[model samples]
Target: MAPRSAVLLATRNVLYVSIAGDLIVAAIKVGAAAYTGGSAMWSEAVHSLVDSSNSILLLYGVHRAKRTPDQEHPFGYGREIYFWSFVVAVQVFALGAGVALVEGVTHVLHPTPIAFAEVNYIVLGLSALFDGATWLIALRGFRRGAGDSDLFQAMRASKDPPSFMVVFEDSAALIGLVIALVGSYLSIRLDLPILDGVASILISLVLALTAVFLARETKGLLIGESADPAIVMSLLRIAREMEGVAHANGILTVHLAPRQIAVALSLEFSDELQTPALEIKVSELEQRLRALHPEVIAVFVKPQTALGYAEAVERRRGKTRQIVFHTPSPPGPA
Candidate 1:
C-alpha cells in the first residue's frame, strides 16, 4: 500500500485541478447561457459554480482537520472533513438541484427561444473536455487508493471523503454535460424550446440523486464508522497470539480520520500475571500493534473475561434482531 502522505498529496492535487477547471467551465457556461438563453446551459453554469465552491470547502476542511490534538477536543478536528463534505452535499442539493428545478419549471411554463446556438455548442464541448480531464484525475487517484477492489466496492469501503467526493462531483458534471448537449440539440431541432427546460429538470434530478448519495456516505463517516473488518480481525489475532494474553474476546476500531485509527481491545490476560506484569504486557502489545499498523494512533486495552464479553455480544445481537423484527412493515393491509 502507498504511504498515507502520498495519498493525501494526490488527493489535494486532484482537488486543486478540479477547482481551477470548474472556475473556467463555470465562466464559459454562464457566458453561453447568457448569449443563448438556454435553460440547460444556465443549469450547467450553476452546477459548475456549486462544484467549485465544494472543492474550496473540502480544501478548507482538510486544513482544519490537520490541527494538532489539544485539550478542548482530544480527538483532534479530523472529522472536520466529513462535516464540510456533508455541507457540500447540502449545497449541491439546495443550490444545484433546487435552483435547476425551479428554473427549468419556469422555462417549461413560459418557453424561451434559444439564440446563438453555435456558441452553446462550442462552450459545452470545451466544458466537456475540461471536466473529463478532471474526472480522469480523480478516477486515477481513487483507483490507486482502492487497490484491488471494484469501483462500487471501493466507494463503499473508502474512508477518505475528499478522494471520493471529487470523483462523485466530476462524474455528475460529465453526465450533466451530456444531458445539456442533448437537450439543446432537441430544443433547436424539434422547434420545441420547452425541451431545453425538460433537459434542465433532468440535470437537476441527476444532481439531486448525487447529493443524496453523498450525504448518506458522508453522514456515516461523520457519525463515526469502524475501520476495515480485515484490520480489526488482524488486531484480534495478534492479541490472541501474544504470550501473556489468555484470550482476545473482541476488538473495536474506529477511524478518527481517514489516516488515523483508534483501537480498543477487550483482552483477558493469563491468570499468572500480576498488576505490574499486566501493565508490562499491555505496553508490549501496544508497541507491537503500533509497529505493525502505523495508522493506529491510540490503543486502549480493556480487561474483560471471556464469559462477560460473550454475554455482551449476545445481548447486542438480540437487541439488533428485536429492532429489525419490530421495524414497522410499510403500511401493510389492515
Candidate 2:
C-alpha cells in the first residue's frame, strides 16, 4: 500500500485504541466520583468525560477528512481537522474547565467534606497509568509518522489521526489525575477542604491554557498558512535541478492540505530547450519532483520569455533589497 494510506490506517488504529482507553478511563473516573463524593475526583471525572468526547469528535473528523475530493471541495476535507480540533479545545474549556472553575471558587467560599478518599486515590492512580500508556502509544505513532518536523507541526499538516487527539487528551488526563490526587489527599488528611477546590482551580487553569494554545495554533492553519519553509526549500532545490530550468525565477508553494502542497513556479530555460527535448525534460522533472517530495500534490511550471525572465529577476532583487532594509538586525560590527 502507499505510504499515505499506511499513515492514515496507522493513525486510525491508534485512535481506536485511544478511544477504547478513553472510554474505560472515563467510566472508571465517573464511577469513582459518584462513590467517593470527592470534589477533586469529580473534577477529574469532568475532565475525562470531555476528553472522551473529544476523542469521539476526532475519530469523526478523521473519517470525514478521508472522504474523496469533490467538486465543491477539490482538496478534500483535510481542513476539517482544524475545525474539529478547535471545537475540541472549545468544548474542553467550556464544559470541563469552566464548570471546574465555578465549582472550585464556590467551594473555596464554602468548602465541603470529602469521603472515600482511598477509593478515589486508587482510581486516580489507575487512570494515570492508563493515560500514560495511551500517551506513549500516541507518541510512538507520532514519531513514526511525523518525520523530522516538530510534533505539533507534523500533527497540524497531517490529518486528524486519532492518535494526535489521544496524545493531547491523555497527557491532560494524566495531569488532572495528579492534581486530583494531591487535592484529595489534602482534603482527607489535613482537613483542608479548600485544597480540593484549589486543586480544581489549578486543573481549570491548565485546561484553559491548553485550550487557548490549541485554538491559536489551529486557527493559523485553518486560515491557510504557508507550508513549512524546509518543504518550500526542497521544492526550490528540485526545480533548480531540473534539466531545462536555467534559473529558479520564482516559486509559490501553498498548502492545499496538511502534508499536501501545490507549487507554481516561474522557471527559465537554458537558451530554451527544443520542443521534443523540453517535453522530455519536463516529464523527467515531474517524475523527479514526485520522488523528492511526496507532499507535493500538484506542480505547475510556467515558461517565461527572456524579457519576462529578466523582469522576474529584477522583481526578486527588489524584494530582497526591501526585505534586507525592513528586517531588524542584531547589533554587529560596522
What is the total number of backbone clashes in candidate 2?
1
TM per candidate: 0.93, 0.84
Report the C-alpha displacement of residue 208, candidate 1, in angstroms. Answer: 0.3
lDDT of each: 0.92, 0.77
Task: Itemize residue pairs with steric clashes in candidate 2.
Answer: 157-258
- Judge candidate 2 against the unseen true structure and give its global Cα lDDT, from 0 to 1: 0.77
RMSD of 2: 7.8
Tens digit of lDDT per residue, candidate 1, span 99-175? 99998999999999889899989999999999999999999989987988788778878999989989999999999
Candidate 1 similarity to native, TM-score: 0.93
Worst 10 residues of 2 by lDDT: 319-328
Count residue pairs with overlapping backbones in model 1.
0
Task: Give the winner by TM-score.
Answer: 1
- Identify the runs in model 2 with alpha carbons over 4 angstroms from their true place: 146-163, 274-283, 305-334
